[model samples]
Target: MFYHLLFPLSEHYALFNVFKYITFRSAYATVTALLISFIFGGWVIRKLEQMQIGETIDTDGPQHHQKKSGTPTMGGVLVLTAIVIPTLLWADLSNRMVLLALLGTVWMGVIGFIDDYLKVVKKRPKGMIGRFKLVGQVSYGLILGSILYFGGNGDFVAHTSVPFLKDVFINWGWFYIPLVILVVTGTSNAVNLADGLDGLAIGLSSLAFAGYAVIAYLTGHAVFADYLNLLNLPEAGELTVYCAAVVGAGIGFLWFNAHPARIFMGDTGSLALGGALGTVAILVKKEFLLVVIGGMFVAEALSVMAQVTWFKRTGGKRLFRMAPLHHHFELTGWSETQVVVRFWIIGVLLLLLGMSSIKLQ
Candidate 1:
């Protein structure tokens, strides 16, 4: 809104010309989202409390988590609000990439909201059934993939850029749709699985978005993209504003989501954030880069899968003390804060490594 309303006045005023820069708009978007989150966070928490929406702890989990059973949850509403408002105000609404990113965020957010509602309000311990959740994810993936493949009207739409290899692209041909479906669904679940610890998932997510914000900016600039030998995606530059919003919203939510959290994001925030990241990666032709940028999420998801597979294969033997690498560390005597901080350190390192690939290629 601000972009459309104020940018046109650049012809009459020199200062308004600043609005034409993605960097300028992105910076303001970040600050706007941060302020929104800080200002409205308490009010939203109070509303959730008034509605009796609270967290449901698993009895089989770590002993310390039982105390957090009643903390107000579904705080993702605040996050989504902060992100969407800033993006709408600062981003170019006419950009197709921006519209798709917003759609992915909102669509995944609704799915997560419904699941949280079932768990907290309807008292369904399992929340939405696994199959139903998978269906929702798959459906979104199919729609997104179809749009990118058939509606993109570009040569790179059906191809993905490979990391560490300059000028290399892989054409998935007809398999692109299923690949997208897998990436979207897999990423959404990975973030969900990593949400066991306070601030862990969101903190890492913020870093990932920060890195991608740079990538988006570079990919959108023809000169930079050519110099870096990256896939030039003109429309993707607008995603920098969206990514900035995510970073700010994540940090704002972290204010209350940290250790001894005042509120939980539940599945609502996790799934939406994951979906948003995945969609952005696809838009920028950096799908493989996500594996490195979001390494912690992938590790957490892999741990759960490995644990389950081993348990089933061994017919009784356990793999880790628990599933999700964080819990395993907790069971091994690491304090909760230690696990979260160490994981954050790892996430940061991975983000740097991922960023370096952009130049290395």
Candidate 2:
């Protein structure tokens, strides 16, 4: 909004020209989102409290977490508000990539909101049948893939770059649609699985977005893209503002969501944030890079899968002390904070490794 209204006046006023810079707009977007989260954090928590929307803790989980059973959930509303408002205000509204990314975020957010509403308000333990949730994710992937395949007028390609290999690209052709479905659904569920600990999922997600923010900026810059042998995505630079907003929103939410949390983000935040990140990676043609950027989420999700597979194959024999990796650490005498901070450290290391791949080629 500011770009559309104020940037035009750069012709008459020199200061207005600053709005044309993605870096400047992205900086403001980050600050704006952080402010929005801080200002509205308490109010949103109060509303959730008033509505009696609280979390339900499982008896089998860590005993220390039982105390958080009633903390207000659905804090993702605050995160989405912070991210969307800033993106709309700071990004180029006409940009198709921005619009698609916003659509993915909001769509997954709505799915998560419904799940949270069912679990918290309606008292449904399972919350929005598993099939329905999968359907929603797959449906979103179909829409996004269709748009990317058909909307760009030959600008968009089904070829994705391979990290650490110069001039190496894989063309998925028509199979890219299924790949998109898998990426979107897998990432959304991965983050949801990792949200068991306070400040864990959001913290790692923020770092992932920070990495993508740099990738988006570089991909959109023709000189940098060419120099690095990356895909030159003309509209991707605007997504830097979106990524910054995600980072800012995550940090602001972490202020209240840290251990001894005042509120929980529930599925709303996890799904929306994960979907947004996946969409951004697809738009920037760095889909495979998400494995490295979101390494924690992938590990968490894989732990669950491994545990389940092992349990079934071995006639109920357990793999880890618990699934999701963090709980295993917790059961092994690591404090909750220890697990979270250590996971965050690993996430940062993976982020740096992923970024290095951008240049290693």
Candidate 3:
């Protein structure tokens, strides 16, 4: 909004010229989101508490976590607010990339909110049937894919740039829609699985989005794109503001979400954030890098899949001390903080490795 309202006045007033720069807008967006989270974190937690929307710990999981059964959940509302308000205020609302990213975030957020509401408020142990959640995710992918594919010029190709290979792309042809659906749905669930530990998911998400903010800027700049041998996406620079908002929101939420968390993001945050990141990757044509950027999340999701597959294959034999990878370490006598910090170190390494792609190519 500020960009639309103030930037136009740049001709009349030089101060407003700063709004024309994505870097300037992105920096302020980050600060704005951080402030919003700090300002509203307590109130949102209190409101959730007042509504009696506490988390119900799983009995079969970590015995020690049982103590957190009543901690306020659904803090994603604060995260969502921080992200949306900052982007709207700082980003050019007229940008299609910004609008599409917001739609993806809000869409998955609503699905998550429904699930949390069912489990916490409606007293349904099983919140949002699996198929329904899949439907919601698939629907967003379909909409996004259709827009990007059909909305572009006749020469538009449904392809993704391969990492570490200059001018190389995997053209999915018409199958790009399915690819989008897969990326959106898979990423959202992966982040959700990583939410097992305090500050784990949010911390990793913050790092991932921080890296993406840089990537968005590079992809949008023709000079940077040419230097890096990346596809130049006009107007995609606006996504930097959105990605920065996510980073700031995650960091702000982390202040309260650190060990002995004051509130859990629940499905609401995990899904929306994951979806937003995926949407950014799609818009920037860096879908493949998501694997490296979110490597820890992928491991968390894969651990569960592997554990389940092993359990069924071996006639109930267990795989890992527990699933999601984090709990396995916890059950193996690693302290909660150890697991979180180590995972963060690994996430950081992966982030750097992913960022190296900009030059390594």
Candidate 4:
């Protein structure tokens, strides 16, 4: 869109030179998304409230959450809206990664929207069944994985670029297809589970964008890549712009999604964000490192599964007071805000650790 039409003219117009810098455009993108979310978030929340699209707290799960029953649902729309607009205006529309990212935003968004609609409109207690959601995620993984494998685009073994590896490049074997499917699907579900708290998921997800964006930039710049002994991916640099858009969008979404949440992102945001992260990782050729960068999400998701499995296996029904770890603190007398903020702090720490991997490796 504006990126292409205005970029060529950048050479002729001195002011347009700002468009050449991903950092500059990223700043604008971040501000644009933040403004959009801050301005429109209230209206969207009001509309949802009027429509009676509210949260349905699991009564058996947590007692205090019942008060959140009337909170507006489907807040993920705000994030998607803010992200798409600025990305279109500021990002290179010709980039394959950007196009795939846009497609991922729309595709997973619709899937989430359908689930939210079923719960909010149709009044289905279960909304979408677990199996159906899994199917959707798996289907997405299949599409993305196959595209990466057969599109002839991913044939470049130079794809696996781990920072500080000192010339050690790892390529995926033939089993990489199933491995990729597992990566994308698992990653999406991991983020989906982490989205249970206000600002928690989005905040942690932002850290990933920060890490991957730098990786994208390094990979794209031959000088940087060679100097650092990392893989030099020619077209992958555009991922920096995509990563910037994601960071901007997350901050914007967090504006209204803070503790006393004006709106809840629901599955719509979690799935879409997760899918977006996975797509960027694949494109940037750092699919494996995502495990370390997004470790918090994995830990949160695993907590739930571990608790459930333990409870079912033992008639004693023993586990954390609640799953997701955050709720466990809630049951232990921490306020919602307390749990949310502490989780955010933990996320910040983990983010630093993940970032350290770049230099430590």
Q: What TM-score do all the candidates reach, one by one?
A: 0.99, 0.98, 0.98, 0.93
The candidate, 3 or 4, that scores higher on TM-score is 3
lDDT of 1 by residue, 209-325 (tens): 999999999999999999998878899899999999999999999999999998999999999999999999888989999999999999999999999999999997889999899
lDDT of each: 0.93, 0.93, 0.92, 0.79
Q: Which stretches of model 1 miss by more than 4 angstroms?
A: none
lDDT (Cα, 0-100) at 155 in candidate 1: 56
What's every prediction's RMSD, in angstroms?
Answer: 0.9, 1.0, 1.0, 2.0
* Model 1 TM: 0.99
Q: Order the candidate numbers by lDDT, best to worst.
A: 2, 1, 3, 4
Model 4 — TM-score against the truth?
0.93
- CA deviation > 4 Å runs, candidate 4: 153-165
Off by over 4 Å in 3: none
Off by over 4 Å in 2: 153-156
Tell me the lDDT of candidate 3: 0.92
Residue-level lDDT of model 3, residues 167-211, one tens digit each, is: 788878888989999999999999999998899999999999999
